[model samples]
Target: MRSLAPQREETAMHDHRTLGRELDLFDTDPLIGSGLPYWLPDGATVRHTLEEYVRDVERRAGYHHVYSPVLGKRELYEISGHWTHYSDDMFPPMDVGSDQVVLRPSLCPHHALIFRARPRSHRDLPLRIAELGGMYRSELSGVLGGLTRVRSIHLNDAHVFCTPDQVADEATAALDLIRRAHTAMGITPVRHRLSLPAPGGKYVDDPDLWRRSTALLTEVLDRSGLPYETAEGEAAFYGPKIDVQIADRAGRQTTLSTVQVDLHQPQRFDLHHIGPDGARHRPVMIHRSIIGSVERAVAHLIEQHGGAFPAWLAPTQIAVLPVTPDQHDHARALVRRCADLGLRAHLSDARRGTLGARIRQARLVPYQAVLGAREVGDDHLALRLRDGRRLDPAPADQVLAHVKDLVGAHRTDLW
Candidate 1:
């Protein structure tokens, strides 16, 4: 049996409140109410960078981007069966005089509407549609955390509509895309959880479909030779799923992503395509999210790196410091050079304090500081690494090149 004592002890040691405040990432505003986050400028930068990364990956994986309204008609939820099954998680319906609408708690129903918009044929069988949608869920106040649990969430939702014959191939492709994304984000040793419904539980009423779907997912995992564990009673009401878990610094496991094999939604929505025999047939739906939620993933990255972000993800990758007021112009020039090279940089003038004090301040903020000075009767600068090592700066072009290379390499250790 798993002990809850260790979980309580671990929670005490890693206080998210202190980390969130110290890092200036996110904060709860009383005026905004609980479960809502007001991301500071630094936190916003990290969030946007992560979104861009995911968008690029989705585009390369052949997903067509789409946008849906945050509020949907009450009838849509009824058709999707969310009104009956997951209604507790949704916001109360608002009566718009003639019609009732509720804040969206998930993107699946909206994506289904997109599929119903047109008459799809077998040629468009494997239709991949993705959306970075803002969804709302009314959480109990006690469950709210910085970014881990929230009232509003941005999800990287992708739905693959494939014919029954192509379902396995599409599932494999989705898994490949997720693997590539984990690699890009430096999430190592990815673990999978084959989640199924508990026996005689709130699963879809078809026992045969559940058995076949679970077996298919198991075969995929086995063929890939990836280590996984069976998780009973963790599946969605619609179907079984594969949960991707990652460990943090404290060794606490969290679900970072998921790929669910949904066999009910497509049929409920009557999604169909023309088959080779010219007969109408139901298509399979595969729901994949490489990063579970934008806000939650950012929180995980924060704790994983302890707020010292990698070069590519850092808000300020480099800080320029002038040795004296006389070198202020040189420092500003370096900042511009870095900016031109697509690196986030800041200039620290020496008038505020002594050179050593300014360097210490830069270090406190955890940025790579460059100290500009006069050396050997020539204008020169010293590159101060995050580890306190100082190196003679080369030409401006050479410095920019090196910084670009470092960022490209995603070097977390070098500074």
Candidate 2:
């Protein structure tokens, strides 16, 4: 906790855009068009790890993962009200003979179709569907910067369909998941926002629907006892939302996670589940994102940690730098041991630079094992932690156990 202020200062000095280029994490090619950045091998490794973490969390929380199309029929968006409320942010429709398809701007419409694919009963109430999906938004080039504001997004998105009576509980649970995800990634939300529609804002026309959904989320926030501020014109077009806000390097607040209570979408799609009494009833749709977009989340993470990510999240967790050519075989053997222990370890280029320079070069790595001629066996390999602490040579089994425990537990400590 004491390191928070200093770390944020470090983040401000180490903007992700600059680090991305220097670290070879990700980049934008002019041929790929603006607002679309390609992830390098290292960047993809981090993104894949984050996605895996999100999947594990969602699964434990009773959400079933799904894969949906990135393109949807034009009528699909129209039926979901996106055509009317959000078409401006969406790409132009692509014509295919008599029909047209558009790049999806959100996952809910497809998830909604999944819910309606087969008749569901009350037993299936609170059906939670999750996806690490790709979507696109047509942003003006000027507004696009790095990964934070991109056209292509791989989102950590989920939807919960439950009875109206269960909305509050589901929303609370969703908030908990979001908090856990943030903490795992070393992010702290500076504030929580209850986003509502503004005067004459483009929202669902039904007064009762808006009122009910807003009160539901407001009560959940109040019951959770987390202080929040209400923001006008900051909500989704279909409903009000509780946004988890974090400040970026420039100290500008951006929403990273959100839980939105929606009544309009289910109604628009005419979605329903059969009650225990055999009557058709509307199921409330609660849309939530733990870490909204992979690109934006990684952007925040890179800046927040200054690319010195916590042990579990570091793309290359450890670098094995052999001090001399004589120790080359020893270094290769140690890297294999690390791989066997599930650590991402790479042998640094001992051929290119001096040993001291190589150690300094891998500063972003969470751990470094520098094996020299004197350090003959795997059992006596010394460690240099990222925070500049040096560990004396210890038994290889004991050392690997401790390091593996920390990484496996997703901990920050490197002892």
Candidate 3:
């Protein structure tokens, strides 16, 4: 079994809470709520960057993106089994006249209703619906800390509906997507678990459905040549799932991505599709979350790289510093040019601090472009990286091109 405790390390200097406060990434207001956090401009930029990347990846994987409300009618969760199974974790409902509605804790039930909106045919066997929607949960105040454990969550959630014959292929594709995303984010999976039902009645009461789903998931993982452990009683109430636990730089394992094969929700919601034989048949639902929660991913990444983000995802990619007030115009012009090239750049003028102090401040950014009298007169730039490596005078075009290349290629370093 994997332990939930974080490994002891001398990480106080690089703690996410400290970096978040110092860099002005996010803040929590007690008047607002204990577990709720407000993202500052810098933090929002990082989250928006991640959201765009995930959306593009999902689009390429043939997913149809959709948006749903954060509040749902009480009946919705009742039918989906959340009212009975997850009542303790959900927020209290508000009485809306004769009806009651509550903030949604998950997006799967809402997506299920969308699938039931219209009739589908075998041609639309694998209908993949995706969303980056916010969810609310009533977390205990004592356990709330930073972005990792919050009451509000924004998830990259998707649900796939397919025929029984298409289950294996869809499962394989979902796992592949998870692997690709984690690899790109520089995360390593330390363990995999094939979660199954146990003797407790916490799961949906269907022995045959449980056996079939477990067998199918096992077969899919075995055929894909992926090694995993069988974890009994760890499955969701409606399905068996495949979970990949990723280890951070501090050797802490957190399960952020999952692929579940659900055999209960479709039947509860009466979701169906017409087969080639022109008869009504129930569809199987596959719930997959590649990056899981945006807040959690950002928290993990902050600790992973110690707040020095990758070039492509950094809020401020470059900081331009002029040696003195005389060269302020040149610094501004370079900043504009960097912006034109689709880079996030800022000018560190003398008003903020001295050139030396500004250079030290630029450590929060990825690259620093130093402009002096000699370079300005020569129409060149003196580059100093965050790592304190100084580059000789280089032509304007050459430097800009290199910066653009690094950003485009998602390089972690300026070199």
Candidate 4:
């Protein structure tokens, strides 16, 4: 029995499929193909909430949101150096008359074209563009997990174009944004890694530029007081990058976000802006993603919270259960009140199962459940918090007010 205890505990902690089934969050259908997710209704709500959060954050940071097509002409990749450098990661190109089209693996080149849509001056330097864009990559079929690795990803992608003088400041500001996002989501602080190119490898082939870029990134980390590991030769072909890694409950580290400085892309794309001296000069590019992808972030959140989402982010903030058929009307009214207060709530009919069974089911998925009943002549609701605390019978308005505060305050874990 003692030896069996450890195995049972391990099974309880690492069982993601159990959480997925219990919460009715997501599932994959064979008919839909592998590496694809069929998001259940509740799962879609969670995804949308994350998207809104990122979009709002980006807007406040002075980033102009833009939309680009999922497919691009083959020639675009040719000029962007992706064809030669990252061909293995891209999806197969499609023949459309004389032009070949391929699904966009990244948004940099498309955003560059947007920058060139019109002429720009030094005033337009430090232009930040953001996109909650969907991209496709031909990932190896065997490596695909639920949401961690997917063929289609709605990336919280952004790029900043700025002058040489503004590089450090822009990088710092981007880091600040990412920190705020992680803090809000209750994600653990991540270890930063400074990713540089390997010596004598397929880097940008400019040693001076690599050294300068690495120095700038190192300075930013120092000024921010962020502890980081420097990985030699791990940089992208175009620039040095900062990879933010977070540890899961099992202590496996995964990259939650990244910020990269690119000095090569602007030159490759011939991107330039009018300088203060009225001359066309190249602009540097910085690419960043706070959460990386909506799907993967959702998966991480589930694992982090052990499938018990915070009130604000939960698909169903509160579940109302009636103790008897006589209390069904009161429970329904309570659900309506929750909805009016902008909380997601539902009423579970008492006829379905025993009170203990219903409570156990709700608690297993781990949502906050309320039990309404009539002990005396008047009506009241009992609050069962996710953390196992039970509140005395309270009036509907009082109950609604408390739940509203909990959700608004983002107190999902505490309750």
Q: Which candidate, 3 or 4, has the higher TM-score? A: 3
lDDT of every model, 2 decimals: 0.78, 0.90, 0.87, 0.81
Top of the candidates by lDDT: 2
Instruction: Write one digit per residue (lDDT tens) for candidate 1, span 128-149.
Output: 9999999999899898887888
Q: Where is model 3 more than 4 Å wrong at Cα? A: 1-9, 248-250
Q: Compared with the true structure, what per-residue lDDT tens digits does model 4 show for residues 308-334?
A: 776678787787777788877767776
How many clashing residue pairs appear in each of the predictions shown?
0, 0, 0, 4
Provide the TM-score for each candidate, comma-separated.
0.90, 0.96, 0.93, 0.91
Runs of candidate 1 with Cα error greater than 4 angstroms are 1-15, 364-367, 375-382, 387-392, 409-415
**Top TM-score hit:** 2
Candidate 3 lDDT over 1-415, as tens digits, reads: 7554543444665667777877888889889898788999999989998898889889999999999999999999999998988888899999999999999999999999999998899999799999999999899988888887899999999999999889999989999998887766766778889988789657788999998888888878998899899888789889899988876556667778999999899999999999999999999999999998998888877877778888778889988888888889988888899989988998887777888898888886878888889888988977887777888888987898898997776566667
In model 4, the clashing pairs are: 197-233, 198-233, 310-412, 311-412
Model 3 local distance difference test score = 0.87
Q: Ranking under TM-score, best-scoring first?
A: 2, 3, 4, 1
